[model samples]
Target: MSVLVLNTGSSSVKYELIEVESGERLANGVVERIGEDAGRLAHDGGAVEGRFADHEAALRAILDVLGDISPEAVGHRVVHGGEHFREAVLVDEGVIAAVERLAPLAPLHNPVNVIGIRVAQRAFPGVPQVAVFDTAFHHTIPPHAATYAVPPEWKVRRFGFHGTSCAYVAERASALLGSDLSAINLIVLHLGNGASATAVQAGRSVDTSMGLTPMEGLVMGTRSGDVDPGLAGYLARTCGIDADEALTRRSGLLALAGVSDMRTVRQRADEGDEAARLAREVYCHRIRKYVGAYYAVLGRVDAIIFTGGVGEHDAEVRAMSMAGLERLGVVLDPARNQAPSTGERAVSEENGEVAVLVIPTDEEWEIARQTLQSVRRGAPQLGDHA
Candidate 1:
């Protein structure tokens, strides 16, 4: 099946036309700066700079450029599925309403996601559109782990993000280890601008770092992860700062190092910048704590996966994160880890009990795969949801 995957953000939309059977990307592009003067669309080895009034306009332009390739299915990347969707499902009015109700949990993502769906519905009237959620894979998280220590009436609990990446990496880790996913224990660290640590036991998400929203995991580029719960109240009483906005956009490595990009933080840290050094230390320390915590959660982790932008390319960060963990049997060989390598490969010492691997995440491919799978299962046909 050829699936057109759409990941809609607040101000831009990213898309990829993927041929699932052959695992080849048929076509891919991104539309940026919606509702702005500097709008751009980059597709098929070409670029266009123009005005994109809204999501509908951006998608219509893409349709005009795509011309004749009719996808078997259209997949939408909806960030938070809440507790409703456990896997990919065909878009319908009920589904759309459910997603709408969950918008409060992910205000920055889910609303725009539904906008993309509505636009695509107009663009391809009869095509089956699938909503592949980022939180669906963690649906198996046991209640004990998902529960927060808050009042039951408040109702919020951990609904992990990065499920798609964690699921994809865990599958690859099983293949690399020559074991069935259902029989292995693994820890997946998705270290992108937004990061997470998931403990996968027997291919199921037993525990994860992200909670309720994406802002409660390991420190991220702009999001402050795992801040004290009393901060909001304290700040409100003191200076009346909006804690959510500040923490979500003005914290983490950004707040610590005066910049959010990990590459820049590393450079500045290497130059003996105190703030950058502390940022690196705090980031790695948070990861180390999660590694230890999830290790206990899983009991025995067969392999540790490092993925996403920072996890895949930053050797120094990887080294520091796993440092002093030899007792837990995670031994990264200095020679192997520092060696120049790319794609999915191991970096742990050969004799170590746990294998450490660096696998670049393919979220688009995962979304396409899930869409194809759901559609093949005779999932419900798309309805007039928009």
Candidate 2:
């Protein structure tokens, strides 16, 4: 049976229909600008541009287009599972209610994801729907690493995101290294439009860059990662801006360079824009610092794996992030780092202390794989197909 993975966001829904056995994506696309004018639903390797008033409507359009693809199971990427769900779970009323109760933890993600789940549940009755938490993989993180120095009443903690992708890449990196996964300690740099670094020990997340929400850690396309906690209060008191407004809306590379898209930032930097240049430096510097921090955290690092859009494609970013870290046993070969390719490859020097690799992240495939595993474990008689 094919597994359909749905990752719903505040204003977008990214989906993939994957053949479980072979882990092949049958089709995948995203619906952008939900609840806005000129909304779009791009699927089946084609895009449709029009109006979608809400997540429910967008999902209806998606189901209409998925008429011919009869998926037996569905998996949803639920961003914030809080401390409740530590693994992928079959969606049920209890699960949905728990996700709803946890909405405040991921105000920008969980509510919308709940909407997608409910709508899809109605659209495809009886189909097993699984909720895979981004925080799930990081459950293995030791309490010392996950805890923050905050008030006990607040219950605030560092719950990492991009775990599904990290899990997949770490496993792939282990295979590439030909080392036992349980013996390997990997640092995965998931650099996309939204970026993060995860330190994996024994194929489980020991620490990650993103915390609580995707708005922490690395400087992202739009989200400010790791600013002083006092900045919000300062902005509110001095600049007359509210805390929430200051953080989730107006910050990060957008605030740094007056543009959020890295492509634009890169172009401006190329044209000798100091702000853009500094922005890139700050971005790469943040990554390098995380690498160093994680190195200290892990003590014995194996391979450094790069994934996601920027990590896989942007050679310069990869090189600069690991630039002066040769003393730390991390080195990238100049030629291999710049090699043009979409497939997985190691960009590190031969016999380098640590293998620096570029592995394209396949979050959907991971979700599908986990979903199928959960299904097969529960109901082994289910027919498997690719």
Candidate 3:
């Protein structure tokens, strides 16, 4: 079976066509800058120039690139599944309505995800569409971990994001260590534009840094993580900050260093830029705090896995975050950490008690894998290609 995985954002659409049974990505690319004067589609074949005025237009352009190839099933990345959806499910009218009802929870993502689903439905009529949620994996999080200290009437809980990535990397980490996933504990740091730290014990999430929204976790490119509950009201009373918008759009490394890209921040830090240097420290420090907290939660962590853009590529982040944690058996081998490689490998000492690894996240593959499972019930783990 082949699954087309679609992740629709406000201004872009990321897609991948995978041979789900074999876990081979047959085609993949992104349609970027929708609703802008300039738009581009960069795919396995190369780049194509065009203007995508909307999600429907982008979907049409994608079909043009795909030509005769069609998907048997489609897996869509829905950011917030809320409490109702515990796993990926076949989509229908009820699913779309439910997703629309939960839009307030993920104002920025779910709406666009629905847009992608509608468009994909038109493009691939009669095909099954599966929603692979980003919050579903953390549904196993216990009340003690997921519950916020507030009135029950508020009806808010920590529904962690990056679950597709988490599912992919955790399985790969277990594979790399040659251990049963159910036998070891792990701390997975997914550092990208949106960052999160999850504590997985015995192959299930016990605790995670993100709470209710992606904006509550580790410092991200532009999202503020772990601000005081009172800060928003205080800022509103004083500086008239649109706390919600500012926190999610104009904070983190962007607010601290005047830019959000980790590469740019690191570059500036290297050149003795004080603010940029501080941004790096703040980012790493937040990660270290989560590592230490999760260490206590897990009791014994077998490995620390790093995935996503910054986590896999930024050697300094991997080093600084693990620094002074030797007592906790989390030690990074300097040479290994600095090695230039995109493939999954350990960056920890040869005989360290806790392994530190960088596994490039394959979320689309994970989604396709889950789509297969949803469509064909007893689907086994895909081939050991990664």
lDDT of each: 0.88, 0.84, 0.88
Clash count (model 3, backbone only): 1
Off by over 4 Å in 2: 10-12, 32-44, 47-61, 376-386
Tell me which residue pairs clash in candidate 3. 158-212
| Ranking of candidates on lDDT, top first | 1, 3, 2
Candidate 3: residue 134 lDDT (0-100): 92
Q: Give the per-residue lDDT digits (tens) of candidate 2, residues 1-386.
A: 79988988666788889888876778888887676677788887789999988888888888788786668999898988888787787777778888888876677778888988888788788888888888889988888988888887988888998889899999899889999899999999998767889999988898999887778899877678898988888888898987665566567777889876677788899999999999999999999999999999999899999997778888888988999999999989999998887898999999888999999988888888889877776622222100
Q: Candidate 1, after superposition: displacement of residue 358 in Å?
A: 0.7
lDDT of 3 by residue, 153-242 (tens): 999999998899998999999999999999999999999777999999888999998888778979988788999889999989999998
Residue-level lDDT tens digits of model 1 in 291-342: 9999999899899999987999999989999999999999998888988887
Task: Return the lDDT, model 3, position 263.
Answer: 87
Best by lDDT: 1
Q: Which regions of candidate 1 are displaced past 4 Å?
A: 9-14, 29-68, 378-386
Error of 1 at 267 (Å): 3.1
Worst 10 residues of 3 by lDDT: 377-386
Q: Which residue pairs in candidate 1 collide?
A: none
